[model samples]
Target chain A: MAQLTLVQALNEALRHELREDPRTLVFGEDVGRLGGVFRVTDGLQEEFGERRVFDTPLAESAIVGSAIGLALAGWRPVCEIQFDGFSYPALDQVITNLAKYRGRTRGRAALPVTIRIPSGGGIGGPEHHGESPETYYAHTAGLKVVAPSGPAEGYQLLRAAIRDPDPVIFLEPKSRYWTKEEVDAAAAGRLGQARIVREGTHATLIAWGAMTARCLQAAEAAAEDGVELEVVDCRSLVPLDVDTLSASVRKTGRAVVVHEAPLTAGFGAEISARLMETIFRDLKAPVLRVTGYDIPYPAAAVEAAYLPDLDRILTAVQKVLDY
Target chain B: MPSLRPDQLKELYRLMAFTRRVDQEAVALQRQGELTAFPPLTGQEAAQVGSAYALQRQDFAFPSYREMGVAIVRGVDLVEYLRAYRGDWNGGLYDLYAHNFGPIASSVGSHALHAVGWAMGAALDGGGKAAIVYFGEGATSEGDVHEAMNFAGIFRAPVVFFVQNNQWAISVPVARQTAAPIHRKAEAYGFPGLRIDGNDVLAVHAATAEALERARAGGGPTLIEALTYRLGAHSTADDPTRYRQAAEVEPWRAQDPLLRLAAQIDDEDFTRQVVEEVEERVRDLRTRLLSAPRAEPEEMFEFVYAEPPATLAAQREELRQWHS
Candidate 1:
C-alpha cells in the first residue's frame, strides 16, 4: 500500500496501463511536457515519447473524435478533455459517436477509450471552468460515466475504464486532485462496484467525484449531531450501484443525494426519482437532495454557494431525519 | 474498380424504385396520420442506392436520418425504419449484424465522427475493411464532420465520406452552407475529393467503388459529393414551397435517376414484376410493423446502458408508476 494524491494515482495508472499494454496512448492539450494543467498526465510524455504521450492542437473535438478512431484502430486511448467546460465542444463526438459505436457496430468494434475530464468547482475560475456535465454523458445511452472521489478509486477506475470494452467518460474532481489517500495495490481492478467508504445504518449519502469528499466531510460533521451517516463513493455513475443504494436506503429509510451539477435536470433528480420508486414504502422521509443551483455554474467568487457543501448536505440529512 | 455488370445495373434500378416507394409510403402514412413525421429523400435515391450498392458486404456505413434508401439496400427492415419515423423506438430493431447500419442521427452531422472512428479502427487493426459515411451537404457545416475528415486524413484511415448534396438543409439552401464547393474542402485536408452527378446512379456507383477500392489498398480517405436535389418537403412537418422555387425543382424531376434507370432498362415487364413484389413486401412489412407490439416501455430503460445504474432503474419504475 502506498499513500498517493489523486493526481499521483491517476499518473500511476496511466503509466501502468501503458507499460502493461502496448496499445495504450495518451494525448490532450498540454498533456505532454507540461504533464497536463492538473498534472494527472505528468511524466508520461517524457517516459513514453511523443507518439504515446503527445500534445494535440487545442481542439477538443479533434482530441475526442480522433481518439475514437485511434481506439477503433485497436489503441486504448486515454484522452484528457482538460476541464469540464472544455468538454462541451466535443459533445458531438462524445454523445453521438463514442457512446453509440459499440452497440451500433454490434461488437465488431470496441471503443476502449477513456475520456478524462477534470470536473467540479471550488477553484476560483471563470465560467465553464468548474462545471458538472456528467449528466449529459450519463443521459446519453452508449457511454459509461464514472467519477472517483479520491486517489485509490481514481487509480482503479481509470485502469478499469481503459480496459473495459466500452467508452468511458471519466470525470475527476478538480478540487481533490492534490488530496491524498492510502491506495491498496490489491484494489486496482475492483471498479464498477460502489464502495461503502463509511458504513452506518441511519441514512445513506451517495455522491461521486468531488461531491463524495464533501459527503464524507458531512458524515464526519453529522457524527457530532448524533446522526450516523453512511457514505457511498459512486465510483461508476452510469452503470450505477442500484443494488447497493436500494439496500442501503431500505435499511436506513432515508437518502440524501449530492452532486455539483445544477439542481434541475441534474443526475441527482434521476437518483431521487429512482429511490422514491423502489424504496418509497421503506422511506421515513422523501429522499432529500442537496445539489448545485439550476443555473450555469457561476464565476469562482460565488462558486462555493453554487456547489453543495457540508452544511447543505447536513441540512438535507437533518430534514430527512425530522421527517 | 469493378466494372458495372448488367445485373448490378438492374439491381440499382430496383433499389431506386424501392427507395422511392418506401419514401412514398412514409409520406402517405404521415398524411393519413398513421405516422408522426416523414423525412422524404425523393430526389436523393440515386446517390444513396448507387453508392450503397457499390460497397462490399464487409464495408460499414454511417447514415444520417435521410439515408433510409441506403438502409433498405443494406438490409434494414423497412418497417423498423418506419417505426422510428413514427416515433416508436429510438431506432428500428436491428443490431449490428442484422444490418451494418448505425442508429439514425436525429441530430445533423453528428454520426460523421462515428464513421471516421470506425474507419480508423479498421485501419489500425489491419482488417482492410473500409467504411463509407453518408450525410447531407448541410452536414459540412457541422464541426464534427470537419473533425472526422481531418482525423481520417491525418491517420490515413480507410473511409469514404459520401455527401448527398441535396441542395437544401431543412429550409437552408446549399449556397448558404459554404462558400467553397463541399468536395473541394477535402483537398485542404490532404485527400482527393470529387463532385459527381448524384442523379446519375452509374456515376455514384463508379465513384464510390473507386474510393472504396483505394481505401482498402491503404490509399487513405476520399470525399465524394453527389450533387443532387431534394424533390419533396424536408419531412412530413415541412413545407418546401415557402423557401424553394418550383422552377428549381422541375429540372431535377426530369433528371430522376429512378426514371432514367426505368427508361434505360426498357423492361416494363421486369419493372412491373419487381414493383409488384416490392409492394407486397412493403404491405407485409407495414402490417408486421404496425401490429408489432409497442416496445415494452421498460425496454426504453433496458439498453440505455448494457446495465443501467440504480438511478435509471429507479426512474424506470417511477415512470411506470406515473404511467399507472
Candidate 2:
C-alpha cells in the first residue's frame, strides 16, 4: 500500500492500463510536455511516447468528437478536457453526438471512450477554469458518468471506465486532485460500485467526487452534535446504484443531496426526485439539497461561498432532520 | 497498390451523377410537400465522392447533413438517406458493417470532433484504419472543428478533415468564415494542409488517397480544403438569389464536377453507359424513397436511450392508452 494523491492515482491507473492493454491513449493540452495543467497525466508521454500520450490543440469539440471516431475504429481513448468551464465548446459533440452514439446505433456500436475532466471549484483559479458541468452529461441519456472521491477510487474507477464497453465521462475533483489517500492497488477492481463511506441511522448524505469527502467530514462533525449521519459516495452517476441509495435512505428515513454543480438543474435534483418517489413513506423529514447556487461558477475568492462544503452539507442535514 | 479499377472509376462517375440527380429530386420533393428541408450538395460532387472512394472498408466517416454524395459512395442506400431528411427513425438507423457509415450530423461542425476522437481510438488500438470527416466552410468557424484538428495534430490521429469550401455558409462567404486560407488552419494545428481543385475528381481522388495512406501509416492527420461552389440555394429553405449575383452561379456550372469527370472517362461508350445507368439508379432510388415506410408518429419517443426514462416510459404508455 502506498499513499498517493488523486493525480498520482490517475497516473498509476493510466500507466497500468497502457501496459496491460495497448489500446488506451492519453492526450490533451499541456498533457504531453507539461503532463497536463494538473499533472494528472504527468510523465505518461515520456513513458508511453508521444504516439500514445501526446498533446492536443486547444479545441474541445475536436477532442471529444475525434475520440468517438477512434473508438469506432476499435480503440479505447482517454481524453483530457483541461478544466470544467472549457468543456462548453465540446458540449454539442458530447450531448448531441458522443452521448447518443451507443443508443443511436442500438448496440451495433459501443463508444468505448473515457473523457477525463478536472472539474469543480476551490482552486483559487481564474474565470472559465472552475465550474461543474457534470449535470449536463448525467442529464444526457446514454453516457455513463462517474466521479471518485479519493486516490484509491480514482485509480480503480478510471481503470473500470477504460475497460467499460460504453463511453464514460470521468470527472476528477480538480480541487481534490492533490489530496492524498492510502490506495491499495488490489482493491482497484471494487471501484465502479457505490460505497457507504460512513454509516449512521439519522439521515443519509449522498454525494460523489470532492463533495463525498466533505460529506464524510460533515457526517463525523454532525455526530458530536447528536445528529448521526450516513454518508454514501455515489461512484457511478449514470447507472446510479439506486438500489443501494434507496435502501440507505429507507433505513435512515431522511435524505440530503450535495454537489458542486449549479442547483437549478443539477444532478441533486434528480436524486432528490427519485428519493421522493421511491422512499417517500420512509422519510421522517423532507429531502433537501445543499448545492452550488443556480448561478455561474464564480471567481475563486467567492467559490467557497458557492461550493457545497462541510458547513453547507451539515446545514442541509440539520434542516432535513428538523423538517 | 491501387484499390480502384477502371470500372471503379466509372462507378465513381455514376455515383457523382446520382448525387446530382438526387439533389434535383430532393429540391422537387421539398416543393411537392414531401420533405421539410433539403441541403443540396449540387456542385461539390468531386469533393464528396472522391474523398469517399479513397476510404477503405475499415475506415470511418463522419458527415455533415449536406453530404448525401459521401453517404452514397460509402455504401449507404440513397433511399435510407432520404428518410433522414424526411425526419424518420430509419434515418437515424446506422449501418455498422460498412465501417459504421451512418447518417449526417445536423449540429454543424461538431461531428468533426467525433471524427478525430474515433480516428485517435483507431490509431491507439493498432487498427491501422483511417477516418475522414466532412464539413463546410462555415463549419470552420466552429470551435469543435478547431479542437478536432488540434487533437488530431498532437496525437497524430489517423483522420482526414475534408472541408468542402463551397464559398457560402448560407450567405456568409469565405471571408466571413476566416481571413486565413482554411488549409492553413491545419498547419496551425501541426499537420500538412492542402487546397485542391475540388471540382476536379482526379485531383480530389489523388489528394484524399495520399492523405488516407499517410494516416493509415500513422504519419498524422491532414486537412484538405476542397475549393468549389454551391450551384443551388444552400437548402430548400434558402434563396441565394437575394444575396449573390446570378453571374456567380453561372461560372461554377461550367466547372461542374460530374461533367468534368464524365468527359475524362476511358471511353465515350463507357461514359454514355454510366450516364444512362445513373439515370436508371436515380429513378429507382427516388421511387423507393418516396414509397418507403414512414416513421410512425409514436416512434419519435423510442431509442432516446437503451431504456427510456421512467417518465418517458409513462408518457409513452399514456400515449398508447390514449390512442387505444
lDDT score, candidate 2, position A290: 91
Cα lDDT, all candidates: 0.84, 0.83
What tens-digit string does per-residue lDDT give for candidate 1 at B1-324? 667877877888888888888789889988988788878999889999999988877788888888898898898877767777776766555664457676676778766766776776677567568888889999899887887788778878799999999999989998999999999999988999999999998889899999999998899999999999889998888999999888988999999888887887888888898899889877887678778766566656655455555556778999999878
lDDT tens per residue, model 1, A111-168 = 8789999998988878788988988998887788899898988898888888887789
Model 1 ranges off by over 4 Å: A15-27, A30-35, A42-57, A62-77, A92-113, A123-127, A135-144, A163-167, A188-194, A198-207, A211-232, A239-323, B32-34, B262-294, B311-324
Query: Which candidate ranks first by TM-score, i.e. highest?
Result: 2
* TM-scores of all candidate predictions against the true structure: 0.83, 0.87
Q: Residue by residue across A111-220, what tens digits does model 2's lDDT show?
A: 77889999888889899888888888888876778998889899999998888777789999988898989988766554246799999999999999899989988988
DockQ of 1: 0.35
The model with the greatest DockQ is 2
TM-score of chain A of each: 0.97, 0.96
Error of 2 at A41 (Å): 3.2
After superposing all C-alphas onto the true structure, candidate 1 shows an RMSD in angstroms of 4.3
